[model samples]
Target: MSIEQRIHAHYAGLSPQERRAADLILDHIDDLALYSSAELAEMSGVSRATLSRLYRHLGFGSFTELRETARTLRQQGVPLGPDGDPELSQHLDQELRNLRKVLDPAGDDRTARAVSDLAGARTVLVVGLRNSHPVALHLKQQLQQAREGVRLAPLPGQTLGEELVDVGPGDVVVLLGFRRRPSGFERLVSFCAQTGARTLLIADGTARRHASSVDLWIECPLGSVGPFDSYAAAMSLVAVLADGVLAAAGEDGRRRVSRTAEVYAELDELDLR
Candidate 1:
């Protein structure tokens, strides 16, 4: 069993002091590998002996064993928290690293090809689920400004089957599939393939499993100092991709954008204030 499971199993049997330490351990489970027993004891406001007893009760032979177990969990893509509270500078550094990987020049050819597909397709469908929805919506909005025939899937209460019914040749499907994707995501990709629609997958490392199935895959790094995954790089890539599509459309795209602005002004659709 995992360290967490062990802790819960023996939680009721722990002494008051051991329970205190256990509570602290549970709160910082992600950072367990980074803390020494002494540091944990200090942070938990308990004696070192209490920490020792707590680990023992958790089925760890020693503190080192406990830490190693936490490390292994982290390596398996578990969203582990930082050793301690992270500063703004640390968060910025991680975001910069992610952007560097996403904007790397080595993948210029891939980006160019994706842009060409989006630019030439007769219809473009942007799909995103869960945390990926906003990005998909934003990409669809941007693409629409560049040209017509752009739409977002699963609009509010709708299902993907309805949106995908007409997707086929001369169509491009942009799928934003980040981590924590639903079980049926792979089947969605397969369905797109069966319909003869060109597919582009923009996702984090977890989507590498499906990379081979799609026509194009753009991987974005989402490591963050905190527990939650960051999407700064993914958002930046969307901007770059939208710009590429706009450039590919040339004067036609410019005219469409101008006309869109004119309509928005006529309808007072935007709140500039």
Candidate 2:
């Protein structure tokens, strides 16, 4: 197993100091991988000697191996945090860190573009099965606020394709899928291609089987909690995407969110009579 995989496997079981070491490595991934143990230890307010012990405990022969691993991860363009390298923990410092990276100025353009597409699209249909459903629903809520003409599929009797077929050339279909891959989602994407609809796939990595059907992609880390995956980063991405749509909507966006509240409140206040 990779150092990261090992770290995660035993993450919860790690003592405070060991976690401190892991946190340090996680906090400054590129730097740690690029520098020596002494350099990395200094950054974490810890001692080099202590870091050396931690490295050995994790089964690395030397700091050189650790550095090599970090370098390899860097080349892979993988972000080091809870999503890419999660540990079993109640807190989600990694997600906040990852969110900051995603919200970086460089990443804002893509967010803006995605939002604009949703706002302008004739229809917006979403797909997410398994753990991705929450993220998909969050997007649906935000887009409902960002602008109208949004829909979520696989609800009630409607299948994902049932919604996919309805999107015309200017419409958008956002599919949320990841991990171990799903052939059925890919086929659904293929069906979307036959339609005139524009497509977007929000995924976790460079894997592109389902990415082929979409015109754009948003990649984020999939955080996990124990056997369960963390959807924090995915939710954050949904937030960012929604912000973009809200930006595009101007006054109309504000009104939509406000109106949604009014309607929901009315529903809640009613006796169902």
Candidate 3:
């Protein structure tokens, strides 16, 4: 049974003090991962004995077992309410884990395949709506220099239908799908799929349930590291994938990039000062 089920099953029978400790745990479960048993007891206004009893009631062999479970759940993308000034070390550790997950050997192989698909496409459209628009724009900017037919979807003041009119075979679409995805986002992907465009979705684990909407689903570690979901992992994936795409583009890509650089230099668009 899940930890929650165990807690609920034995909740009513817990002593009043034990119930108080239980309530404290449920209210701030995320904090438990970083708190010692004695610290948690003090913060919850309960004695160490009360915490021990609560853990026993919840069927945990020891307080350490409960804490370890909390850590595992959080790492698995479980919601832990709003982050509250976590230690800098913890944040760094989490980000390191996130990066490792994305850049591992298996992930590298998948990214290589994605790069191959993108490099062979006639046109690539990047779609980022709401909070994802900036990332999409960044991708488009980077890709435009490397390849000729990169476009950002839903151009300024235009609807998707108008933008996708020319979308068909030999096209690739990269989509950013973070939490609280915009309404109709799934339908938009479905429409792209029907038009024979290969759609790659960059999102969190939550996107697994909606797998059929896109041809490729790259899970980026996303969570509320602070007030918003940290995109460090997603951005790192983008950077690496961008490199992969450029590598696949080879000599032709280099030539296009050289031309773009010449144009930028002529216009003096860069600031070296």
**Which candidate has the top score in TM-score?**
1
Least accurate 10 contiguous residues by lDDT in model 3: 74-83
Compose the digit string of candidate 3's lDDT tens values, residues 144-180: 8778899997789988777788988899988887766
Pick the winner on lDDT between candidates 2 and 3: 3
| lDDT tens readout by residue for model 2, 1-273 | 777677777778766777898887766654455466776776667777777777887778888988888656643444433333335354467566556665677554766677777878988988777556777888897788778788887787766656665677888888787554455766777777677787778876634556656777777765433234456777878887888888888998888878877887878964555
Which scores greater on TM-score, model 1 or model 3? 1
Against the true structure, candidate 3 reaches a TM-score of 0.71
Question: Candidate 1 lDDT (Cα, whole model)?
Answer: 0.89
Off by over 4 Å in 3: 1-84
- Residue 245 error, candidate 3, Å: 1.7
How many angstroms is residue 183 displaced in model 1 relative to the true structure, after the best TM-score fit? 2.0
- Residue 46 of model 1, lDDT score: 97
How many pairs of residues collide in each model?
0, 2, 0
lDDT of each: 0.89, 0.71, 0.80
Residue 158 in candidate 1 has what lDDT?
Answer: 96
